[model samples]
Target: MVGRSVTAVCLAAAVSGAAAWAGTQTQLPRAKALAFGGRPVAAQRHRQRQPSARPGVGVSMNVHEHHHDSGERYYGPASKPILDAVKSPADMKRLNLSELKQLANELRWETLEAVSKTGGHLGSSLGVIELTVALHYVYAAPEDRIVWDVSHQVYPHKILTGRRHRMHTLRQSGGISGFAKRSESEYDCFGAGHSSTSISAALGMSVGK
Candidate 1:
């Protein structure tokens, strides 16, 4: 009877120990899965939680990287057929008012994008986009010699007058001048940074002409 009771107690203890070992084996895999799987699962959940229709409007992710390309990434209106066709003021003359309007919008956006990347006078460049387009449309540039007063406003002018390709090089070392340079292009009849100097230069050009 004593031997049988000892045997029964040993059997129960062994069964409990085996059960506990089996439970530990099952729990380890679950714990590892939770540890490893949680990150990607959470990332996927976050992505799914985001609104598909307006993905960028309110999201506080890194946007500057997406907004403009770095260093000759080719984000501009010059790629458009209309803008591409406009190699010079002569090309601009061929476009109708409607096309010119479209060109102005494209040019404005392009200038804005370029300036945003290259870091220059954005407000001044944007302000004169219409004027630049209209002037090129109406007058014969290089011959008529459209003189920009504070030549920072000449970004659109530069684009219109066969310098669209080199726009990325604005104000860089050994690149195109930010202000007008007579040697740079004939369209730039006078180069002046100051407002007062532009008038005198324009007057000199008018008198010389």
Candidate 2:
């Protein structure tokens, strides 16, 4: 019963966030005008950069095209359906059930890929992709804290939040920590390196709230 109530709360929060995001998008024209003095930053940057006549300077290279012959196999549409659209939980809220399922698949694949490359908690992270997405979709994160027990399973959560771009930096020197740390992100409400403390930490946050 408690679990179901928590799920309900999360879903309500996700919907609210989605509605807010939609509204924000509608106001983008005005926001852009204010942000960039009526000219977009992208246009300004493009105009500012003139190609250098000097050899070996300002030379554009197509590094991604030839960096790996098998890059398409890893990053093609089949493996990254809903994942590419998701920049945060607000984006996840825009997805329907079918899209959410696709997102889960993409999350799992991305997690596997990152783990294979960086060597961290693969099995645990793979096992919780759907659960993490569902939770983030329902709850207002960084506000309604979702504490993980022995947070080796939190890679998917990190990716769903604002840290997907940083997945390649997992567990490296000066990179994201292997376990959840409050300092790492607002989404990481409670630090978890060991088991059996998540419930207590969540209770503490709940009571404090």
Candidate 3:
């Protein structure tokens, strides 16, 4: 399948990149380190400004926290999950192709688990699971500027970029945003809810540079 091939290529590339940067961690070519006046821009400004329901509490993907008459819902791993080791994109480089594939599976499960409760865009996010994993794993984010068309397609992106803990609170009052928000995370370079805006935004970011 085309999707399977793509994932394989991405994993292979990630392995190569990781090996290249093994001795001394070097920035990926596309990665532009977050720099403003030669200092790291505030990473969690949005969280600091607007706190979520359970700050610092990791979300459990295995089961539904809410009780329903139907039954308890279970999603990903019960213990020692691949996703548990991945708090950010950088954490993905160490995983082999098999592990990367497993991570993608877990990431998909996490996305479904979060969106099922919060009620946001799901199809688009699911569609790009492998792509998101590849992008984050292959390139450096916040600096690399991986813009998504119709920002709702970033749930998996959010999960990979240090927002997994707040995923359960998504789209709620005082919670993480449904669509991308620049203040929400450095990884979200451009924020747009509607379609066909990603090209323009990418152009502007490129031209500005």
TM-score per candidate: 0.62, 0.63, 0.65
Worst 10 residues of 1 by lDDT: 1-10
- Which prediction has more favorable lDDT, 1 or 2? 2
Model 3, 1-209: lDDT tens per residue?
11211111122233454344333222211111222112122333333455456879653322112323445434445653889999889999898877877777688778877887889888677666777777777777765777677677789889999999999999999999988899999888778775676656676766666
lDDT of 3: 0.66
- lDDT tens digits, residue span 33-126, model 1: 2332244345545665778566466644321221122232324444567787888889887787667777776787678666766788875776
RMSD of 1: 32.0
- Those runs of model 2 whose alpha carbons end farther than 4 Å from true positions after fitting are 1-79
Sort the predicted structures by lDDT, highest score first: 3, 2, 1
CA-lDDT, candidates in order = 0.62, 0.65, 0.66
Using lDDT, give the best candidate's number.
3
* Model 2: per-residue Cα lDDT over 11-116, one tens digit each: 2234455444333211112222223223334444554576677777674522222222333233324548678888888887778876777777678777877876
In candidate 3, residue 71 scores what lDDT? 55
Q: Report the alpha-carbon TM-score of model 3 versus the true structure.
A: 0.65
